[model samples]
Target: MAYGVENALAVCCFMTPEYQESKNCQKELLYADEQNVPIIPCRIRSDWKPSSWLVPELPTKQFAHLAISNKSKSGVLRKTFLIGNTHKELTRKTAHGNTSEWTFFVRPPSSDRDSIETYIKRIRVYLHKTFSPPLVILDRSPFEITRTGWGEFEIRVIIEFQDEWHHEDLEIFWNLTLRDNESYEEVDVEFDSYL
Candidate 1:
């Protein structure tokens, strides 16, 4: 039934038992090669030699021996997820015809700020899963906090987002907090000047 609905230009494949333990995309790509369709291997595994010259080799390497194509050069798939502390969950969505399924979720709490970079990098590593659009959906913003001392420090931020994003309806605002050193008293201020 899957084959009946697939495009002639698309690559069809079967999961060989040998590949059951492997998360490598090469095996399925090899199958696509048999169908004369272009295959995009997520990454190359040192242990596995590319069995055949299935698709044209991409000039850049993504993961290990895996070559990423021109379409994937921008790393669009990996940018969908958000990483932060206090609020962090991953949600992925897949759609077919009129029926759409959403797998994205904020499963784990963002308690480890130190590990945020590692978490985000790992999310980017799974770009293969998001070949399609908007596979990941994050909550409003990631972890954000403002800590000010007696003096101010220089910072950089874009007042607006890139053109590709739908920012028309989005409202972005920030709040500042002041914590007393001696008493450890806390005060919330909408404007930085008040603190």
Candidate 2:
């Protein structure tokens, strides 16, 4: 059944394990509620919860990326390398429909830093499985990968360096969310730091 925006909400009347895994069901549901109104996903045997970050009345799209900095010193070379961690988060809930994209990036402090790119490239190869596509690195300036999903979830990022002294890679598990900044006070405070 086609769900109208004015219908208040859409409740999955029936949910089968097969249906849950099918791409058709996801596409249909995405179309059914393009405006991103609170959708009551199938509860037949699922524990999925609607995203709390979205507020429909505001009618706005959100695009924000979170960045984490990792610093390490090479004991052998006695030099320190700075790695900037960031993500690409995009959420669109307009008349067009509700869509989102989440990607992660690891790079040196500046665009012209080629030496640091070498380390980033090696880390990308080492953590290929962590990425969705698992592509090899041809450039080292920035290593990045994008994930696919309609709902928000936590993603694990592992960055390995070429430091002989440090044998372990830096691992980070981030929960990616995109929503109206005004609705979340913590998000507001975090954004303030960038400014």
State the weakest 10-residue window (summed lDDT) of model 2.
Answer: 184-193
Which pairs clash (backbone N, Cα, C closer than 3 Å) in model 2? none
Q: Model 1, range 171-195, lDDT digits (tens) per residue?
A: 2121111121211112111111100
Best of the candidates, TM-score: 2
lDDT of 2 by residue, 2-91 (tens): 544446564342344445456666655566556555544433323232233223412343322223223322112322343222333345
Tell me the number of clashing residue pairs for each predicted model: 8, 0
Worst lDDT window (10 residues) for model 1? Answer: 186-195
Give the top-scoring candidate (lDDT): 2
lDDT of 1: 0.28
